[model samples]
Target chain A: MMKDEFLKKLRSHLVKIPEKEKQEILSDYVEHFQHGFHKGRTEEEMVRTLGDPRKIARELIADYHLERAQENQSFVSLFRATFTFLGLGFFNLVFMLGPLIIVLSVIFSMYVTSLILLITPLFAIEALLMESSLLEFLLRLLTSLIGAGVGLLLGMGTVRFSRTFFGWFIRYLKSNLNIIKGVNKHA
Target chain B: MNVQFKKGVLTLCVLVLTLKKDRYGYELVDHISEKFLIAEGTIYPILRRLTKDGYFTTYLSESKEGPPRKYYQLTEAGKLYAEELIGEWETFNKGVDQLIKEGLDHDEG
Candidate 1:
């Protein structure tokens, strides 16, 4: 086979593989044919020895599918982890952390900027005079306590998010190793 | 052997061997021919097939004597596929062995 003829036949055989992979496969064989030519084999002799391209193409296609399947699996796992992390972050901010931070900052501002110094004595006198007002102060204290609780929940949730992402990554690595083992056994 | 059968099995065998390490094209032909009486040309198709399938990936390394030699190595998927084929081969060989033994016994009787 002429060098061009050999490449043409090989290209036809490569139709089953994805276009990018087909190019890669062709280039390797092209290199092989060139090496053979340099070693004193004529292009015709090299092509003849390489055998039927169609049969070669079929087998190559099978291998390509297997590889693609493995890659697709990993990509799915990665996507799942990414979505999970994003969901958790959104939930934490919207439902848990955001409210807690707002409440805590409110209480801190009230504690630091209270202008009720002389009025504090009057409020203490009123505490003795009116039980209903004292009950109102207790209710406000309870709301601040709930704010602290929400802050704690957000902190714990952030830790859990990190752990889940790491766990997913580890699973991806293990599955990849198994795929490599399978390929090795066939080889 | 049927051409299709030979080609399929030869491609698998070449992929499996290349998994352990890289081998130049001619070296692969010589190694496989030592075990199976095949035309030197047959190995190239198998190599091309394996590379196309993604069972093996190839690169060129400089050679001392001539042009750069193309060396093939097994990719991860190729390794896994090789293992599966090896397992299937073992089961096939066991079944064939039993049948062969039965045939021999009948012939002797």
Candidate 2:
């Protein structure tokens, strides 16, 4: 196999990578061929030594997505990365999906709880305004103020937790990826 | 050895070799493959990962025979990482050696 054919096969397999990075990756293979030829080796010899282009492209694409997921910290990129790993057969869908669902629920519940707490004060105020007795209005106003204060505190706590969780979650996913890199094909 | 085991050892070889001097993709592939058989194409992904992690920095330098080659140098961060990995590898290697020796003796006995 010559340089062009080898690189074409690799490029086809690695369609998911960004253009710049994809080119950068291909250039490495091209340089590898040039260097091999300079060393008095044939293109076929170099190609054989390098193994299958499809497998090489798969490893690189999985890794590229993993980095994108870690850097962006967005759901789309992270999910894309996970899906790529799933294709590589390194990560099980149950393992990845289970934790993802669990974490999402925790975060979703936190936000919902904060929202409910915040609105409780408004509900109290409306009820107080309709109260015929001034004493009843006072009690409701006091209780409502307490609810609002607690709600504010809870909102701030959730924000802090989310930030910390974001940092921890990225770190967790990255460690998972690093381990995957050493995964044997048969395993 | 399993491919994962080979890859871990290859990663160590790459880091240890680069610590001595910078190396290009093909050069490192040849140097490491001389000691351990591997699919030479796989090294590139590891190189890309270490570079992305900021442990190694890459630059292109002209070769006398052809197009310029991408060379990887160990950064300050990479040096630290290499040291830690080597340390862990040493301890692990020693333990493996001990276990294998003991197992062999047991088999002989």
Q: Candidate 2 residues A1-187, lDDT tens each?
A: 8767888999999977888999888888888887888789888878888988988888787677667766665666666766765665654444767888787678778778777877776776687578557777777778877877787888898878766766675666554543423232222
lDDT score at residue A170, model 2, on the 0-100 scale: 60
What DockQ, between 0 and 1, does each candidate earn?
Answer: 0.16, 0.44
Which portions of model 2 show Cα errors greater than 4 Å?
A89-97, A121-145, A176-187, B1-3
Candidate 1, B1-109: lDDT as tens digits: 5443454467656766777688888778767867877756557645665565567887878878777777888889888978876675666667668889999999999
Scored by lDDT, the top model is 2
Per-residue lDDT for A1-187 in model 1, tens only? 5768866876786554578877866776776676676667787876676766765555455444434434553333333433332332212223433543464455444443343321344444454466556667666455554555555555555455444544554444223323323223443
- The superposed Cα distance between candidate 2 and the true structure at residue A36, in angstroms, equals 1.0
Error of 1 at B19 (Å): 5.4
Tens-digit lDDT track of model 2 for B1-109: 4444555666677888999899889989989888867888989888988898898999988867676878999999999978876766766767668989999999999
Clashes of each: 21, 0
Looking at model 1, give its docking quality level: incorrect
C-alpha displacement of A41 in model 2, angstroms?
Answer: 1.9
Q: How many backbone collisions does model 2 have?
A: 0
